[model samples]
Structure formats: structure tokens, C-alpha cells
Target: MDELDAWFPYETYRPYQREMLELAATCARNGGIAMIDAPTGSGKSSIVSALLAERAGKKVIVAVRTISQLTTFIRELELVRSRKRTLAYSYLIGKRSLCPLSGGGDVYRRCEGVKAVSTSLMRERAGTGQLVPSRDPVIIRQMKKLDTQHPIICPYFIKSRVFTGGDGNALRMLPSTTLRNRADRITRERVLPHELREMGAGICPYEMLLLAAQKSDVVVVNYHHLFDDEIRTQLYGSLGIEPHEVHLLIDEAHNCGEVMQGVMNTAISGPALLQAEREILGLRRQLKQAVAVTQIIRNIGDFMEGLRNSHEAEDWFDPSIFDRIVVRGSLYRDLSEVVDDLMQISEHIREKNRAAGEYATTAVEVLTAFMVRLTCSAPDPAFLTVFRRDGDEIVLEVRNIDPSGRLQELARSHHCCILISGTLSPIESFRRYYFGELDVMTKTLPNIFPPSNRMVLCAGDITTAFSMRQNRENTDRIARYITTFASLAGNLAVYFPSYQILETYAGILEGRLSSRNLIVEPKDARDAGDLLKTFLSLPARGSSGILFAVCGGKWSEGLDYRGDLLAGAMVVGLPLAPFNRVRQMTIDYYRHKFGSDGEFISYTLPALNRAEQAIGRVLRAPEDRGMLVFGEKRFLEPRVRSGLPSWIRDEMAECSIDSFAAAVKKWK
Candidate 1:
């Protein structure tokens, strides 16, 4: 294999790349589900890509959390293709974003009038230098005919006319016809790869997965597309297939439970309901002119009053109970009638304001749908939340709880599923929530970085109780510690739990550390980047300064500040989220679901994951040297410390921070 490796661009695998790939291959062969817990820079991409390349006949779908990650994976795949000269791939974006023109479809006829006028202008310029506008009804009719069928395609010719200053020269410039001819020839050959087929080009990746499941071997998408109820229904409903037909690979599987809960939970607040009532009332005022609007407004008012009354009875109304109040019989009968009334009035308003056009209709439809969905009874959890903003107006928000079951059902129907991520630890929790009865294979790869090179420190006394923002004495102590620490370190990044804490600590250290370079996380992205750049570029004196940041924020993850760019990290707090009603309710919800100790599964564990993610930021490579400072005292607790990975525990036993200044002195 080493000798054959000359054919590849990269010579070696990173950490457990081969093992993960082997597992993936085994899973592929047996048609079983596999969950991989590989850390960042662990070459998970190569492992997955290898599996994809080997499995030519089987379509593999890769789903990630963000579009940016998807794009990155696509680029990595492209790089592999460049080296291996095997496998074919194409990007499938959301269906709404698919280009109708690119697919050789006649979906642009809606803009035929513009197309015709533009074409006429082009022709007139071709024959004569003067621009000519056409108003002939016959030409207009023909253009309208073309527009109705090929709106997206015909618009190019129209746009060409505009670009060419109403001259046909742009159209005459050719190449499109030649390209089309080439495409036609290619299509006839059938030798072109399945990925080259024009069939699934314009559909969303999720939709494309459904369409090409039997054909293409691999599909990639975000976590939301697979887990979100709306997207899941759309894909499954359109494909008419069960989830079991597809293999499951959940990348970033650690966040699966959180994503599942997020999709499943729905909340509506009192203030938002009140605002909706006002808006409905405003529409009702137009009732003298539009009876439909008036009737719809009255119905909305009734619904709002019922919602308020339900809330008044209890602080929280279970979605099931609320549904019993709103939805009756079939067709969402109550809300459906309101939708009909609103739709009628909206149409009238649209006609009256032709300039307003689709916007008016769209708004009406959105509101109508909202009302209908609000009133419809579903098995999902729903909550009514109230928020008070300034200016005397209260906001109400309504949301559904736990859409994960629906998503999982959809995934099972599809067959093969893959969930991948760096942070999925204590994998059982995620599996219990996401896969449930579905059998799943799990693997956790060792940290990609060599454990010996990086030093992890856990300060025993750093607690939120002693946090600077919460206590002035603690602020002074932290500042003194940081100043002394900077005297020894070349470069450092100190992470705070929140912006308030960062600001408070930075204020304490203001004038004392003038000689030392300092960078603070700005409130905005561009500013933050700028600060990081300044810090990175600063001359590396034997003892440099600090970069202050917030934990679990943009700078903490998705950043590489290795070597001298970052020498030490002062983690001020455990990153436990502040106490809030919603968080309390979330804790209660989990407690009810999984017993009293379930709060650990629901809240505490996730918070610890975030702290772990922050710690991960400092150690980019095995050769990097960094000191991790945990300022929170609660982290010393047995329960909290137990949640940390084994490697972290081993490191903490060796390098513990007693006093901030003393800990700083020991960094080197």
C-alpha cells in the first residue's frame, strides 16, 4: 500500500483514518448503520471519501450541519478526485435554488413579455445601429407564450438584450448553441458518469437523495435537512419511499440529540399572540371595504382569546391539549375557514394594488398557514412563551416541541444514514434520542493530536462564584493573575463564558498590560477577525500578551491559532448558560422524560461539551504548546469532572491550577 500510495497526493492517513474507513466499509457491506466519533483533523473526510469511491454502485448520502461545511467537504472530495482519477460527483443545492434554465427546462415562460421585448430590441439593434422597441400585440403574444413555458431559460436571451444595449450581437456571439449541442452529444454517449446526468441538478440535496437513491452512490447535506420535520416530510413525501431504503451516517453525531430536541420542541409566547391579534385587528379595520378581511380578523381574534384563556388556566399548555381546543374534525376546520376568508380578501387587495402583486398574496398565505398550523392538533409538543420588550409591547412566540421522531421515521424509511461530528461523546445519549429502536454501530477514534505534546490544565479554585463579573475581588485576583501569567507566556488566549465577563476582566487589566499585546473578541465578525490578525502578527517577544474571547463563540471553534500564535488559554468559567425560564423548563422536561438525574443528559452534558470545544481551540497540532486555565470552581466537582474525557482527566491530574499567577508561571 505504501508503494501504491505514490498514486495519491497525500502519503499518510491522519490518526485513525484507516480504521474508520474500514468500519464504514464493513457497515456498507452489511447494510447497517454506523456512528463515527472522530475529532477534528482526524481525516474523517478521507475515510468517508474512500468508502464513497469504493462503493460505486451504491449511493452514499453525507449530511452535515452547515452549508459552509458541505462546501468544504465538496472541495475535499474534488481534491481526492484530482489525485485518484476515480468517482464522479455533483452538488445538489436546495430545490428552491435550482436553476430552471440550466436544466434545459422550459420553466421561464412566466416572463415571456420581458423576453419578447428584449429580443425585439436585440433584433432591431442587429440590423440598425438605432435601438427599436416593439409594441406589436402579435409579437407580444408570441413572447408571452414563450415566457409561460420557459421563464428561467428565456430570461437569458432577454438579459443578453439588456447587456448588449438592445443589440442582438450578444445573442449572435453564440457558444450557447454549441454547448447545448455538446451536451446533447454527451447525453447520447451514456458513458458520462451518473453524476453527470442532468436529472437531479436543480433539486435540493435532500430531494436529490430521494430521487437518486437507487442510482447515485453518495449524497451530502446538512443536519437540519434530515432532522427538520418540514424538510423530512417534503423529501419523503416527494420520493414515496421509506427511510429504511437508505443507510444512515450522522456526521457531527454529538449534536444530534440537541438538533433533534430543537426540531421537536415548539414554543409560542403570550406577547407574540397579542401582536398577532393587533395585526388581525388592523386588517379587520379594512373590513368595511373587504368583508372577507373582517370575517378573518374576527376568527383570528377568537383564536387568540382562546389561546390566552388556555394560558391563563395554566402557565404552560401541552400542544395536545391546545390542539383539542383549536383543531376539530377534518381539514383544520376552524383555521381553514379563517384561511379561506383571508385568502379571498388578500386576492381582492392584490387586484386593487397590482403593483403590490405577489408580495400581498405571499403575506396573506404565510399568515393563513401560520393560523392553520397553530390551530391544527399534532402529536408534537407546543409551547406559548411570552417576552417583554421595551416600548410597552409584549411579544408572543409559538413553537412545536420534538420533531425528531418524525425525522427519525423518515430516516429509517430511507435505509442508509450517516451522522458524523467531532464532539459526539458519551454516544449512548445521542443514540437513545435519535436512533431509538433502530440498531446502530458506533466508533470513537482517538484524538488526532498526540496526547504528550499538549498540556491541559484544570484550575481547582476558578468558579463562577469567584468570577470577576460576579465579584469585584475575584476580578482583581483574575487581573493580577493574568498580568503575572503574561509576564511568562509569549502569547495567550483567555476565554470567558460571556461578553459581559470578558468586558469586565479586560477593564480590570486595561493599563497594567500596556507593553503586552492584547486582542479582545469584538462584537462583530469582521472586527473579531481583525483582532485575531493583529494578535497573530504581533512580534513574538519572549513574553507576549493575551487574546480575550468568549467560550463556545466563533473564535473558540473553527479557528486555528497554533504554535506561537496561541501559547496559553485561560478558560474563565465552565460555560454554563445563565439561568433562564426556558432553560429551567428544558431541565424539567428532561427530568420528566428520563427521571430526576436526566438533567445531566439534557443540560449539564451539553454545557460541558461546549467547554471541551473551547479547550480544543488551543491545541491544533500535536507539536503545539498551550496551557488551559479553567477559572470556574464548580469544574472541580466530581460530577462535572467525571463528564470530561479520560485524556482530559489524565492531563488534569498532572497540571492543576491552584492560584492564577502560580498557574501562569507553570505554563512553560
Candidate 2:
């Protein structure tokens, strides 16, 4: 038997499962980066088995974007442990989910303040005769004295641990036996974040998970735990794990660039400046540098106002002009000096607020962080400074155009990195866009599901181009196509390029489709969940429904439409972003970096990916039969056609609206 057999939970291998396992094993043995473009239902979750087989002593960290994905791996690890009961695993999500304390503040900063006070009180009690400070009478009294609504110290953290009886030199701390027992139970059972929170009535769930992670062979975390620098540093430091000792696995690898960009981006708004100026003035007598900081804040506001007057919505702003305003308005000689003063004042205010049991983040701290990023990223061409109107306020933003440099740094810092996603088609484009010139291994697995179960059609007559969208003839054609598809037996979803397009077609077909239910995706996300619940119930009631949604919106991705729930889907057009100044600047930056292929790689590929994601909602299982329609003439172009997955390209039929109606009528 092969060594990997011990880790494999199931006795049978689906098509290409053994091959993917072996490739992952090899990648783990030889340290570097590897990208895998495996389709859904290819047993991508089982790749963790191969990593476990090869992990000699290093810790494995699997990062996911959402809670559902994290739960999927937790179940998979449980199966692996069924084969090897001694294998242990744990997971860590955001603090907002795990924390028991509630207040209007940044969770991380609030956690820091509470943990500091909790640890200090615990140590003082331990200095006396009380070894377990949580049970100490004096400590309990102090904690009870704090306001229940907004306590400065955390009761969960205090109750989560105990200290060894000794003096300062020989003192030590350990997880309470009760918390350790719960941690052990989590390794043995399928405990989700909410479940763990319930289980932790009196203990800190995060502390319990940390205790489990320290002894386990594998640890699961959210994407921010690995993508953000401060979070990564704090997580690694707590785990006592170093860079070389880490083996990283990133699921939904397609979101890597966007997530990294979010970490690097920073902004300050006009309203924020007003609040910061008020804060500085309130501290004028005590803060020595208050006058200089207040002037700088006012000048920055004026600078943003000037940019807003010159640009319509969003456009590039000169960083040199910003620096000149700051230095000329204040006593500081350079931008860095002003940033240092802001940082100092922000920290002072934070400490003062924490001492008063008010853990809210001040507006000045937000400006301080933005200025720091602006000063630090000015020389890098990948970072673009722009001003845009958001609602009623003008905001200045520093956006990171390309994430390849940060991705490269993250990949090289680890022992071995594996990024896997179901939608990473045209693997070469993604590799170039993610790693630049870095030597990275790549794989594109074949579609394991039978091709007979699904049919794809690309329109040859209709187009949703900007110029033709308003044409009465083109609008009627689109309405006719949707009304025809509404005659099908089950739920049909049509995704448009934007909400405006969706509303245009929806308005034309609102009362026209009385035979079937018409459900349109809401702009507000809080209302979307309830509407989705309504959409999913139509098949069970023996009723048919047609949904109008926009690509890249809430309903287009991260959803599971299983058998009969979604019988067919249509992507109305290429879901390109709105052509605006901000988008053009991003395209121009990429063109400079990637030469001729810049616009296609940066702009076109993402739109195609979003379209595929919407269509891929159908055919979730091998036995599931469904129809997919690409509702635009541009899909027939060679460049766009070639970028689709081979499975889609092979089964696709190019048709006009009349032919599409004929095909749907004849479809099984």
C-alpha cells in the first residue's frame, strides 16, 4: 500500500483524485508555490490528506474566505482523523464571532485593552496566595464592580486560565482544565464557530481554540489571518510558529489578489476630517502638538475639496500637491514628520479613552493610519492615490493596483504554499497576474463529471453593449429571450452586467410573466437573504420561478443551488466594470506592468470569471442536468471564447435568439 493510503479516508478514488493527491504530495515535499485549477466536485477538499501525509513536523494552516468553506474542511479533517485518531485539528475565525464582549469599537483594539487589564489583574492575584485568580474573592469583586454593558476587562479571558502557585521567578500559566477539556472535545467533534461560542458560556472560545492549535498538526483560519500583516504577526506570535515552520493552503485562490489589495488600501473621508479637527481642538490645552495637527487636518480637507471640484466622481490626485499643502500649513518640515505627530497624538487619545472605559476608535486615529500609508506608498507605482465622492462626502484613497509583489513575498516566506480554486481557468494568465516572473508550478485538472449532463449556449444575435442597451429593438429582444426562458419547468436565473440593466429588463417583463413568479435581486444585501429563501422554495411547491440578478452581486457567487432548485442560468452579457476614470487608471497601470496583455489580463479576465461563476451554479452534482446560456454576441469572439473552461468550450453551442428558443424547447 502507498504511504498516502493511511491518510485517505474513502476507499475509492474518483477520476483524477489519485493524480491530484500525488501532485500535491510532490509539491509539499519540494518547497515552493503551486497553483491548482481543479473544478468543483473534484474532491479538492481531500488534498489536505496529501499535505498531512507529507507534513513531517511543520504546522499546516488552511485559510478560507467564508465560514461555510471553513466548516467543509473541519468535516474533512474529522474524516481524516477517523483513519488516524491521534491526529488533532483546530480552527480560528474573526474575533467578532468569538468575542463575548459587545461594544462600539474596533474588535482588535478592544480585545487588546481588555486582555491587558485581565492579565494584569490575574497576575496581581497570583502574586498573593490565590493561584487560580478566576476563583479569587477579591478579583471577582473587582470584576463585578465593572459596568456590565461596557466592561473594560474581559470575564471570559479571566475564566479561561489559571496560574501555577509560585513567586514571580517561578510562576507559570496554563489553560484551565475545563477549557482544555472543551478544546479536546472540539478536536473530536464537528464544532463550528457559533457552536463553539455556545459551548463557551464562561470560557473564551478563541483561547480554547488557541490551546488546541498549539498541540494540533493542522490549524484552520480565515483569509484575514494570513493576508493582513498585523493579524498575521499576532496570530503567529501567539501560536509560537515561525515562517519556515508554516505550510500554507489558500482555498478560493481566485480572491487572493483582491484580499491582498484590501489589506494594502487606505482612505480618509471629508466627514472624518471634520471629526478629527473637533477632537484636536478639544485637546488643545493638554496636547502640545494639537495646533500643528489641527492645521494639517484642515489643509488635507481643503486638498480633498479641490480634487472634488476638479474631478467628477473619481480621478488621480497629485501626491506632491498633498505634501506641499501639509508641510506649508504646519511647522513640520516633511510629510513623515506630520505623520509621526499624528501617530503620537492618536496613541495618546486611544490610551486616554481606554482608561475611561470607552474603547471606541477615534476619528484622528483613522486619519493617522491613512497618512502613514500615503507617505509610505508614494514611491511605489503599484499604489495610486485618488479622490472620489462617496455618498455625501469626498474621500481620498490610496489603492493598490497590482498584488503580485505582496503575493510573491507571502509565497516565499513560507515552506510550501498551495492555492486551489474551482474557477481559476486559463491558468497561465492567473499565474502571471499573481506571481509576476516568479517560478511557480501550475496544474489544470480535467472535468471529472460526465459532459452529457449539461449544455451551454452562446448567443450570436443579442448584445448588451453600452450603445445598444437603450435601443428599443435590442431591449425588446432581451425581454423576449427572458420571457421565453421563463416558460421552463424549474427556476431560471439571469445575470446582467449591472443593476441598471437588470432593472431595465425586469421592468419590461414584470407583469408580462404572470404564469411564473418573478423575483428580482435587491440592491441592499440585508434584504437579499430573505428573497433568496423565497426563491429556493419555489421548486418544492411545484412552482416555477425566474430571477433577475446582476453579475458580481450577492446572488451571483458563494451560493449553492442544488438539484431542481436551479435548473438553468443565463449570463446576460460580459459583466465588465463600469468604464470610469478609476477603472481606466487601473487598466493603464496594468498595461505598463504587463505590456500588451495588461488590459486583457487585469480587466477582461475578471469579468469572464464572474460570468462563469454565475453559470457554474448549475450542474452542482454529476447526476444534476441543467442548461447554461451566455446571452451576448461578444462571447463568440475567439479571445473570449478561448478563455472559458474546456468543459464549457466543448459543450457550447453558438445560437441566435430564435435558435436558442428552439434549443430550449427541444432540450431534455
Task: Provide the lowest-lDDT 10-residue window in model 1.
Answer: 102-111
lDDT value, candidate 2, whole model: 0.86
- Report the lDDT tens digits of candidate 1 across residue range 1-668: 63223223466766677777777766665665667777767766665564553453554556676555566666666666566554444333443344333222122222233334455555654455433212334434544655332232233343222222334344342223323343333222222223433633322222233333322334565666577767755554544544554554556566666676566443333344444345445555565434444444444335445554332322333444433444443334444565566556555554443321112223443454455455553433324332323233322234443334654665555445556667666666556555655788788777767766666666554465533456666656666556666676567777887887788878878677777767788878877767776777774534456778888776776566767777777677777776556566767766766675567776777777788777777776678767766666677788777777666766674223345456556555
Report the Cα lDDT for residue 265, model 1.
40
Q: What lDDT does candidate 1 reach at residue 29?
A: 58
Q: Per-residue alpha-carbon lDDT of model 2 for 585-650, expressed as tens digits? A: 889988988898898888888998999889988877888888899989888898888888888888
Model 2 alpha-carbon drift over 4 Å, by segment: 167-169
Task: Assess each prediction's global lDDT (C-alpha) against the native.
Answer: 0.55, 0.86
In candidate 1, which residue ranges exceed 4 Å CA deviation?
Answer: 1-15, 53-56, 66-68, 82-84, 92-219, 222-248, 257-393, 400-403, 465-470, 481-491, 513-517, 522-545, 562-565, 654-660
